[model samples]
Target: MHRSLLAGTFLLLFTTAASLAAAGSSTGLDDEIEGESRPAPSSQIPLPQEGDKPEAENGEPPEGNVTRPDTREETPIPDVLYDISALPEPVQRMRKLLMDAARSGDIENLRPLIGTGANRTQMALGGLEGDPIEFLREISGDDEGQEILAILLEVLEAGFVHLDEGTERELYVWPYFFSVPLEELTPAQKVELFKLVTAGDYEEMRTFGAYIFYRTAITPDGEWLFFVAGD
Candidate 1:
């Protein structure tokens, strides 16, 4: 009976050991399956910093990133004057001389009024090399200086402006367009301008940013300062 009891005790101990080993194996299998089914954590991407510019395909700054500047200038328009009777006596006299010479149809008549030495009327910006009258003829469309005479007459007849008032550099410029901004011209003022230049010429001047046509300037003391074209 003691021997039978010992054998039964050994069998019971063996069965309990087997059950514990099976439970541990099942638990380990479940843990491995769960790990495989779970989703992975995503990697993060960093954002660009402020003021950092993206490079173009050519390695330069992107065209959209650059800012361009406006180069056009804003100029004030001066008053236009039609009647020259209110102008100074010397200024009036000089205008009369220019008018009479132009009306006479004789380009040579302008010789005396053009003066001599340092005070000569500036016919060209760089100074005249040959005969002034011959130069005038060459510049005229007709080759006889008739066109130049006509131009002078038209310029003097148009409105003018008294600029730099009270200063030694004061001048009375013809057509008044020299001192007035082209963009600021009124419809009536444009009509006055049309008398001197064609619509095509006006458009060209506008594109050029300022009038670059032939303009006359006379000093306050009746000296003809310049009668030339260009900027």
Candidate 2:
């Protein structure tokens, strides 16, 4: 009877120990699964917003993302005058005299207005060799100088510019192109210029970097300063 009782006690002890071990193992497995499924903490870092774009080292907006504005300055065009009635009395008188002489078609009529030594109208940049009238005739495309006379009339009829106002060098210059940049001329202005020069002549002047063609200048006091060509 004592042996049977001891056997029953051993069996009960083994079964209780086995149950406790299985419960402990199940609790450990549950803890492992919970650790893997739990979400991360709310204190973690966040991603950048759409407006938070990065800049260049020079403080400019990044190249591909922005377009910079053009800050270069443009050249100003000069004012062109077409009316002779707006000129001073002396200037108007001289212009009328030149027009009359040019219309006469007699190159000699220009002589008296051209005046004598020292006050004579300048016909060339470098001084003329002999008589001014004869020199004009020589340079004329035809024998009678009609072409030159026509040119003179055409030059006076074109638009003019008044420069050096209030100064000793003040004068009225013909064919306003003399004071304007070739590159800056408008299409209409270019057409007006074509009336005075051939397309080839315009291209040559552009290459030379200035309007080196025939241009006339008269002083504010009615003196015909020059009717010449060249730089």
In TM-score terms, which candidate is top? 1
Error of 2 at 148 (Å): 0.7
Q: After superposition, how far is residue 107 of candidate 1 from its true place, in Å?
A: 0.6
Clashes by residue pair, model 1 = none
Model 1 stretches with alpha carbons more than 4 Å out: 1-76
Error of 2 at 203 (Å): 0.8
- Across 25-142, the per-residue lDDT of candidate 1 in tens digits comes to 2222111111112111110111112433222222222232111111236533557887788888898999999999999988888888876444555553222333556555544545
Please give, for residues 16-73, the per-residue lDDT of candidate 2 as tens digits: 2222223222222111111112111111011112432222222222222111111124
Q: Once superposed on the true structure, which residue ranges of model 2 sit more than 4 Å away at CA?
A: 1-77
lDDT of 2 at 78: 49
User: Where does the lowest 10-residue lDDT sum fall in candidate 2?
Assistant: 39-48
lDDT of each: 0.56, 0.55
